[model samples]
Target: MNFKQLGLSDDLIKILNKSGIADPTPIQKQSIPQIIDGKDVIAEAATGTGKTLAFLLPLLENINPKSNEIQALILTPTRELAIQITNEANKLKEFNDISILPVYGGKDIASQLKKLNNNIHLIIATPGRLLDHLERKTIDLSKLKTFILDEADQMLLMGFKNEVESIISKMPRKKQILCFSATIDSSVKKLAYRYMKNPIEVFIKQNDIALDAIEQDIVETTDRKKRDALCKVLDEDNPFMAIIFCRTKRRVDELEAVLHTRKYNCEKLHSDIPQNKRERIMKSFRNAEIQYLIATDVAARGLDINGITHIYNYDIPESVESYIHRIGRTGRAGESGYTCMFIDPKNIKDVNEIEDVIGFKIRRRNVEI
Candidate 1:
């Protein structure tokens, strides 16, 4: 359905139209009107399904621009997602003139403090970083009308429950709560039960049949032969953009160096790098300046890059969830993509778990190097 039919104002509908978004996504179709009515919602959608804009639009539309207090609080799992959400919010507020701020770790607190003094209306923040500001009384949440948890699963994975609980305790009880996630487990359900009040649960089952447009396969090799097999696949496929997932920071560093020596424009991402450098690397990768981004699970979560033609799992993930999250990066926007896992002999059990979770057999493609 068109966005205008979903109860969005002419200003936001005009912005969306100019931004090339004529139709509302499934989640937006269901949640926008409910959010406009000031109700709690729990939306389940995959990456690249425009969940950010779905919630951001409603939040912006509901904001009382005259109030200087924080009207909406969007809690994201990572710094990248926080920044991205804040940027989307900024786009919709061209006519409203809302002051949106993104707060996360690895940035200057003094600067955040300076921005907070300017009548902040919306804050897209990571839990720990937002908690820091709350502790220092740097942010005022008394006028909060809405609270959103973006990527709820990842926040729990990052062990931010205490921070989330603490922040919620300080908020006004009458606020609307919205939770969005790619995949929800029992723990996430429990979080919804405790925090949200009778939220309308909306699920977009994209991943079940989502990647019919993409090709998925596995590359089988022993530990000694895995590197050679991956090299052979790269030579054969020659994808325009690929992200190689390594299991550890050291492994990512080593693999990035190896790819660099092989004359590939590759970048490394882990917890070790400075925030500014990480931002630069991601910016370059998104702009196609870098061909590959070798990263650990922590570093790769909540990324919103499109047009990734391939994802090479240099090391199989230990859990099924990680496997899903890793591969969900590619094959987006109805584009065909490929995911090849360099599976070691001992990692077959982990592969099986991934297949079991995905509820299908992952095709194994033999590489003759």
Candidate 2:
């Protein structure tokens, strides 16, 4: 369906067309009308399914353009997601004059404070920094018409439950609440039950073709031969750009050093790296300045890059959901991609769980020693 059929304003539809987004994704098509009608909504969709525009379009349509107060608040799980959403918002409002600000850690608070003092119509923030603003009394949300919890599960996983609840408490009770996530776990459901006013629930079934587009394979390797196995795959596949997922920050650092010694153009991303450096690395990766990005899950979360030819699982993620999230980096926008996993004997059980979740068994390939 198109944006106009979803009841979006002509200006916003024109903006979307200019951005080359003529048709709405399933989530956007289903949830946009509900949101524009001022109904509270809880939407479940996977990563890279265009959830950002699903909520942002309606938000732009619903807000009073003339009101100077902060009318909408969007809380994201990480600084990258916050900035990404803010950028999308800016693009949609290019022809319009609605003011939007993205507030997150790793930036100067004074600058954010100055922006807040100005007439801001929408604020996208990380939970912790938003709380800091609240504590300093530097921003006001009394007139907030809509509150959004983007990536609700990730926020709770990062131990921001209390901070999120506290921030929500500061918003007006009459405002609409929208919770969007890849999965509706217990914590997210609890939050909805406690706070939302009989929200309409929308669940977009996972696109089977997108999952099928990813050619997944596993290589059994001993702990000592894992690096050799990784090199063998890279030698054969020669991906345009690939992201290697390590289970820990230390592993990422170690792998990056080894790759550099082997003369591979690569960079590492994890919580230990400074936020500014992380952003630079992400930018470089997106521009294909770097051929490989070695990262931990936290650093890779909410990354919305395209043309990823392959995803390497150097370490099997701890959860089935995490494995799905890791592989989802590729095969986006109906493009075919590959996922190659290096599994040691110890983590074989994790692979089993992943297979169960995906409802198919991954083909095993012999690692060239």
Candidate 3:
């Protein structure tokens, strides 16, 4: 279904059309109606499923542009996501005329304070920085109309349970709440039920998490020779754009260093990288200025840019969910893509688990190093 059928404003629709986004995604189709009708919604959608627009459309459409007080507050797990959401919001800002601000650490607080004084309608912020504003009374939430928890599972995983609960407590008792998560476990459900009233649940299951458009292969190699195997694959298939998934920040760093010596345009992303630098790197990667982005799972959330044609598992993931999550980055929006996993001998069971979930065996691509 198109966004117009979903009852979006002409201004929003026009903006989306110019950007070649005419249809509403599965998550958008289910959640938009309930959200626009002013219902609290709990949506089970993955990062690549357009979960951001599911909330953004209704949130922006419902916002009274004339109101000066904060109407909507979106809490994210990391500053990068807050910035990403703000970027998405800004794309439609010209039609909406709504002032959107992102509040996070590492950014100049004084600049944020200056923007906070303006007629801001939406505040996309992280929990810790938002809590700091709450405690200092620098931000007001008493008149909040809509509260959104983006990446609910990620927030709680990052140990923001108490902080999230405290932030919710400070909001008005009668406000619309929206929760979007990759996997809605009990904790996310508990948080939603505690604050929302008879919320509608939009569970959009991705039956084909294996992603048919993305070609998959297993590169049999030892841990010590995995880098050589990866280089062989890179030289053989020069991808348009790719995300190289590593298990840890150290792996990402080491991989970046290795690629740099090989003269590959690459960057590393992890929590330790300053938020500003991470945002810059993300911008560069999205613009295709960087050929490869080596990042851990946590840092790679919300990085759903188009044109990502390949995903490389430099480090094999331990779970089916993570395996799908990594590959899902590519083959997005119905585009053909490719993925290769560097599987050491000991990690065969991990491959088996993923194969069991996807109901097929991944083709093996051998590279003798």
For model 3, name the residue pairs that clash: none
- List RMSD in Å for every model shown: 2.0, 1.5, 1.3
Say which prediction, candidate 1 or candidate 2, comes out ahead on TM-score.
2
Q: Per-residue lDDT for 80-165 in model 3, tens only?
A: 89988999999987885799989999988889888888998999999989889889888999999999999999999999999999
Q: TM-score each candidate.
A: 0.93, 0.96, 0.97
Please give the distance, in angstroms, between residue 285's alpha carbon in candidate 2 and its true position after superposition.
1.2
Best-matching candidate per lDDT: 3
Which whole-number lDDT from 0 to 100 does residue 157 have in model 1?
A: 82
**Residue-level error in angstroms, candidate 2, position 160:** 0.7
Worst 10 residues of 3 by lDDT: 204-213
Query: What is the per-residue lDDT of model 1 for residues 1-369, given as tens digits with 9 covering 90 to 100?
Result: 777777889999898889877887787888899999888899888776778888988888889888778899999888877877776777889997689899999999999999888988889899888989999999978778899988998789889888888989889978899999977778888987787888998888755535666677898888787777878898899888888999999998877777789887789998789888998998899899888889998888778787799988999886876676778788876777789898877888888877776768989898898
Arranged by lDDT, best first: 3, 2, 1
* Per-residue C-alpha lDDT of model 2 across residues 1-369, encoded as one tens digit per residue: 777789988888888888777888888988999999999999988777788889999999888878898999999988888878887899888767799999999999999998887889999999989999999989888889999999998889899999998998888889999999988998899988799998999998764327788999999998799998998898888899999999899999889999999998899988778889988888899899998999888888878788898999998887877777788889987788899999989988888888887889999988767
Identify the candidate with maximal TM-score: 3
lDDT score for residue 78 of model 3 = 90
Best-first order by TM-score:
3, 2, 1
Error of 3 at 71 (Å): 0.7
Q: Ten-residue segment with the worst summed lDDT in candidate 1?
A: 206-215
Off by over 4 Å in 3: 208-210
